[model samples]
Target: MTDHETNETAAEVKVDRQRPETPSYEEVLFYERKPAGFWVRFWAYLIDLLVVTALTSILVKPVFALVGLETSGVPWYAPYAILSALIFYGYFVLMTKFFRQTVGKMIMGIRVVSLKTDDLSWMTLLFREWIGRFISVTIWPLYWIVGFTPLKQGVHDYIADTTVVHEESFRKNKLLQKKTPDGSGLHETSAF
Candidate 1:
């Protein structure tokens, strides 16, 4: 080849290297993400409270009976509180790690996601569900931050760098309602 031809080929190669590959149709179809808001999260949490209360009651009853603490006039605070904490941590951590949501969140059509990865991790689950939730429950006002934050993040979400999102919207490949890289929120729509 001539010198000019070699130069042209090199430039073509450089251009090809600089161009970004377009995403596949499947990726475009499956990767849409959307954030869940306060009202929905609140309703889901109420449902979760009922579910957890029932579950805790059931589990505690057997333990109380085994410990011979179920008799009338027995003080219930100590075992109840300890078991409640364990149940809360276990329920949140296990369910969110495996299912991406609690029973309540699932019923409300929501899911939790780690901002760092596609799949949830044990550390994230522990922080978000165990420690972060403890803080939020102790300081009840922290939970209300979900109402004012852009992504509806609460103390637990902030601590874990996670978010709650609308499951169907995410699953259906709809456009996300979160802030874009340029920090814009003006383009969110509900096509579902």
Candidate 2:
């Protein structure tokens, strides 16, 4: 080919190889739903504990009184203690399983969401509320881990792959625009 013809061919190739124009920065407005923090969760737990105590008092105390059974000075292995423990664990397990939140959580406007599955399962409830809660209750300090974790996950939350989130609440999140693979335009994905 002649030099002039070769130059024209090179120009055509350069034009063909030109990438599409894309914006460098794009401001995206979105809502990011944050998890329930430590204080809120603490208040909810306190409320639940009060409810459990009230239930135990109203339900078990009267029954023990009727039967003339001693309510005080009972060991952890005592029948009253066993029944109370059952009520405590059962309250959490059944409430979480059916409502996805306990009464306290409902009052606090928070709910548990399963991360590993679309819906909460029986096994998840058992693991989170019964076994995992048992550990948290025993250690107590493990509950504070929520304050430090990125997702505000506690021991039970980590074990169950669940997170507590505010119902019907969100914070505005601004994300920088990311370039598309073909450099066609800016792209943004929802934080959810």
lDDT of each: 0.80, 0.89
For model 2, how does the per-residue alpha-carbon lDDT over 4-65 read when each residue is reduced to its tens digit?
99999999989878966554666688875679999999999999999999999999999999
> Model 2: clashing residue pairs?
none
The weakest ten consecutive residues by lDDT in model 1 span 22-31
Provide the RMSD of all predictions against the true structure, rounded to 1 decimal. 11.8, 5.8
Runs in model 2 with CA error above 4 Å? Answer: 1-30, 173-192
Worst 10 residues of 2 by lDDT: 183-192
Q: Which number leads on TM-score?
A: 2
